[model samples]
Target: MARRVLLWVGDEAVHEAAGRVLHSVMDAQRAEELMRSYGEQLIERGRQQGREEGREEGLSRGRAEYILRTLALRGVHADEAARERILGCTDVATLDRWFERSLNATTLSEVLDDLAQ
Candidate 1:
């Protein structure tokens, strides 16, 4: 079919047009591949970030619960304000310090004293 078209169109013009069409198709395919690759990478990055956020939330929540339980076991009664502060804290380092203090504290004030500093 191209041979017949080349004969009718003149060989030089037909070949140049054919070359342009081939180049355009190749460029289109290349563009599609690049977009697909970038899209996949973006999706994977989002999923990984979501996983990290979930892990951090779980750690904070678990640490808060442990702090409360440890205080109860040690007979250190956390008042309502102290309880809310401890439960609402999202910093793992602060929770860890509070947990350490709770193990030896006789009162809620003793457990949370460092937070005032």
Candidate 2:
């Protein structure tokens, strides 16, 4: 019943306060078990979120690299600042758009002209 009620609570602060209240009223051993279990769950959730974020960063990095390499192979001259701008971008959609532009671009401006607007 307590677990169900805790799940129903939308606010994290309120949920945590309710957990503390429940812990105070429970027997020591039971409270300890609840704490340990919830603690493990929270740690796992954090780890999962980190892994997901890392995966997204890696994907964006790969896309950026591909765009840079494509421009080089096509003989489009990108200056140091242009290289940095491409490498620094982390948004997948924006990288994809740039990559598409690079496929037929004859100059750096052709690939990144949208940024000027």
Candidate 3:
């Protein structure tokens, strides 16, 4: 029940406070063990979330770079502002669209035409 309540609260500070209270009231060694277990679980969850976020960020960056490379190969000159727009974009679908456009685009304007809509 206490574990359920802590999980339901879903706050790290609350969990720490609860662990402290449990330690004060329960057998010190047992409480310490439980706290360690909970802390490990929390750390693992954080690491997993970080890994997922990093992977998504990498995918976004790779797509953006590929789009830029494709534009360069097609002889479409992207000015500084356009380059920033492409690099800053996090939407994979938009990047894919831009890449498809670059395949046949004769100018930077043509590559970014959908953005105007």
Candidate 4:
């Protein structure tokens, strides 16, 4: 009579040989929780970026409006369309130049000259 020997392997071998044998160990709820957590982190990052962009836009618009008002007081007429165009401009350096021009500009031509410069 001959004696027979049996071989034993770990979980990795078992998983590789067949499909998952411990499917019950991880449930759907845990997976859902992990996905939800990742989504929340992405949303927070987007919100932070949006807030920074909004603050920059607000500051730019305020500066443009101030320049327009100053020009108006100096007897330079800026119609609603022109004011809107000025406010829509995002170039900070241009806005600063316009602000300086507004200080000494007595006519629309002077203000327009600053823009050309």
Candidate of highest lDDT? 2
TM-score of each predicted structure versus truth? 0.68, 0.80, 0.83, 0.66
lDDT value, residue 71 of candidate 1 = 90
Model 3 Cα lDDT, one tens digit per residue, 1-117: 665565565687887789889888899998888777776777788899999989988998998888889889988888999999999988888888888888888899887876667
Q: What are the lDDT figures for the candidates, one per model?
A: 0.75, 0.84, 0.83, 0.68
Off by over 4 Å in 4: 1-30, 114-117
lDDT of 1 at 116: 65
Tell me which residue pairs clash in candidate 3.
none
TM-score between candidate 4 and the true structure? 0.66
Q: Comparing 3 and 4 by TM-score, which wins?
A: 3
Worst 10-residue lDDT window, candidate 1: 1-10
Q: Which ten residues in a row have the lowest lDDT in candidate 4?
A: 1-10
Angstrom error of the Cα, residue 42, model 4: value is 1.1
Candidate 2: clashing pairs of residues? none
- lDDT of each residue in 21-43, candidate 2, tens digit only: 87789987887777566666667
Give per-candidate clash totals: 0, 0, 0, 0
User: CA shift at 15, candidate 3, in angstroms?
Assistant: 2.0
Of the two candidates 1 and 2, the one with more favorable lDDT, higher being better, is 2
